[model samples]
Target: MKKLYSLFIALAGILCFTSCGDDYAYTAPEALDVTKADLYFKAPGGTGSIEVKTDRELQATSSVDWCSVSVSGGVVTAKVVKNESIESRAGTITLNDGVLTSLVAVYQEGFAFGIDASNLKTLNANAADSTSVIVTSSSPYIVNIPSYAASWLSYTADEDGKVTFHFTKNESGAPRGANVTISCDDREKSFTIRQYDINSFVGAWKVSYADGEDLYEEDITITSPSTGALYLNFAPLTPTVTPIFHCTYVNGGLKMANGNAQGRYSSYYLFTLFSSTDGYISWAATYTYSASPYIAEDGTFYMVFANDGSWPNKETNGVALGAFTSATATNAGFVGTLATYTDLVLYK
Candidate 1:
């Protein structure tokens, strides 16, 4: 019995010596290291994360309801909500390891921009009729006006936190258009503006034959009896017969229909004697088709008259006149002169 008890005592002593090898237990230092101290998010909020380089477990929390934080595998991620207001916002993300604490600043941008033109996309051409456009944004924005429109369009900010755009009167006869852009942060919006002056074309215009050996230059008068009816005096083109053309507005220009009874025309021989005064026999005759005429964007006018069968160069006995004297004018040389009358352009 004594030998058994001595062996058991020796084993117990060995176990105690093995468990108490050192006076104090070994413990690692408490530490908390975060990779990032700040985070940023766009207006359309999203997720952002930072790396925690510590050996201890940590808890992450956000100070604001708009920003939420979570920790997984030593990575702290923050989720931000979409900011609808125009004002920017900031929050703090706190990380704790029981003994140490770290902080991360979270910033989010706002998304709000608008342009109020009072539902008007076009403006009148009168210089006295100036207009304004209102702008609304949540953040600072930049206005970009095209180089061609910068001279006529301007903007100003009022003390009441309102942005207003001013437009100068457009004196150009034809319609003018431009696109204005507003930029805030990474987003941009464009608005198109148009100005037109319909009555600007009603005035005396210089006229000349597109194709004729005779040097003919005169002033043609254009009169508008109503909003849609325009009358152009043809006395400059034909001295003998003063045909007046009844035109209507078509696509920002004037157009005359074929065989329009409103337009009265007469041949040089039918109206006046060849040896009467001018000594030149004008072969101006009626036509069948008149091309659509339009005013170009550059304020130039263009008109074209084509022939398709309906030529009135026949004699009293229904015989073709063929060709005449120095005043010889063929079906192609009588009215509108050339196939395309671009040389007879009128300018504003």
Candidate 2:
């Protein structure tokens, strides 16, 4: 009976020792190593994921689901998920089982005008990105004066912020300078009076003829009607010899000259002033004459002569007769050379 009692005591002591050991024994959870942490997108909109790592094995049961995450008022709350492999993901994601959370900023594409031409006749705007913005005009707008494609009228913001626009008269017979309003992204701006004047119409012009085989060396001067009367002299060197006249504003058309002159009478003279946006003029003229004659109506003697002839043939002949003998005349034709002129001076 004593031995039995001793055995029970030993068993009880061993049980107490085992219970103490069990109370003291414990394994700490592994700490997650978040080597890299950042919000993928700095600008607004889109999801951001957090990455984390650990040296020891992680339990799936302790991991949190990512779909349950939520972000509000610019604050992001994510559920931690155990992903062993380092990789990118979408939506709100937490790293290392709730150790770290990253929130992506939400943003909408924005546009701005680096230069504002609202007060002027033209409007210019710069884009922040490759984004495109719809542009509308409040008052009637005319694009591409002189031409559409060659004119700088509209612009798309390519990655770089460079853009240009040109504005002018919209309706036919519109005022020289008219006001216009430009709008973009619900923003509106106004431009003052605009003009499509000869200043913008005039360009480097060359005169060519014979199907462009021959080109004349000359320049053209465009004088505004407001300044004074306008005239185009064919040969400025000899203004009187060959001059072309035109009205300052002749029914919006250029006045032209046409006439006939006698030969020798080198009607070589062709002075016609015409209008041309293409920078060209066509001038022409004609000449004619009658032949000398020898005739008699009352059977009186008469003679025909060419060149200069002298009657009463004396070295210093002076004669007086009761009647006359003959008389004559002739005809001829003449042509002139083409010439050109301009307002711009060119170096030889």
Candidate 3:
């Protein structure tokens, strides 16, 4: 009878345990949690992971095509693609478990493609004429000047940050240009070097004038010479030592007045005219050079002078006008052929 009573008690305990199933409860894992402290990626690109704890089923995605994302075994995985361009890029990685969400920034470095400025200068030929272009990256860089521009353009850098570029004056007739490049660090920058044309007629020369066989050979210093006009100073000083040649471009013709360039003094010659009946007469005469210094296409030059004013206009004063040229023509003598014996040539 006592054993039967014990069996009954054990059956009662089993029944109570079975009846408690209707009041049972369940618990979830946890809210979203991330293990990574940084969100950036490298250029070569690779797969990275984020340890996450969530209460419900979760999914992961990327805002940019450069980044891809997925989730497996309670962990969010992100894959960053390689950045092959010359520019840096950025994007975002997103995580959500239906309601709660999280975002992380993704970044990758590109090439070193920038400088402080886009334009480069020339006639930078001077120490005072240097251009400091700041480098935009930490990688090593190099400067390149074209072969044709080797004589003028160049580059110099003490270390990196700011580099100095130099250039020389252009001496060509037409405008000139070249390409200047900064290369290295997987990138480059291009700059154009443009320069103006050089002026002609800018030096000294010896000049020769003649009345007979071997006449006057003098050094004539030309100053401020240009296609427009020039100032001429004679070595063998004349009463009016300085003359101005007002030039015309069409045919390279020149004109000058009786006075000097500043018109301060007149170019006058004092002489005596011998007349058979009237005896000898003294006079001061002035001549104006017009269409004078005509430079021919073949490089030959010519000049002629006419009387501007005279004290006595007599037949003996026929030496008023004179003409000269660089041709092989012989001098016509001071008293023959209205054209006096004259020659003008470059002395040197």
Report the number of the highest-lDDT candidate: 1
Question: TM-score for every candidate vs. truth?
Answer: 0.40, 0.25, 0.31
lDDT of 3 by residue, 87-158 (tens): 778777677788766665666666444687744453232222445577765345778777766776677787
Candidate 1: worst-modelled 10 consecutive residues by lDDT: 1-10
Q: Residue 225's C-alpha lDDT in candidate 3? A: 52
Number of colliding residue pairs in model 2: 10
Error of 1 at 224 (Å): 2.5
Name model 1 segments beyond 4 Å from true. 1-98, 102-110, 119-121, 159-161, 168-178, 185-188, 192-197, 204-222, 226-348
Per-residue accuracy of model 2 over 1-348 as CA lDDT, tens digit each: 011000001112222235645643344343444443333321122343333354333222212243334433223343433222223234423322354322222111223322333333221122111112233322222222122222223333333332344342333221122223344334455442222322321223222122123334544333344442443322353433443333232222222222222112122433322212244222222211111212232221111111112112211111000111111121122122233322211111
> What are the RMSD figures for all models against the true structure?
18.5, 28.1, 22.9
Clash tally for model 3:
1
**Candidate 1, after superposition: displacement of residue 304 in Å?**
16
Which regions of candidate 2 are displaced past 4 Å? 1-94, 98-118, 122-211, 219-348
Query: Pairs clashing in candidate 3?
Result: 125-167
Best by TM-score: 1
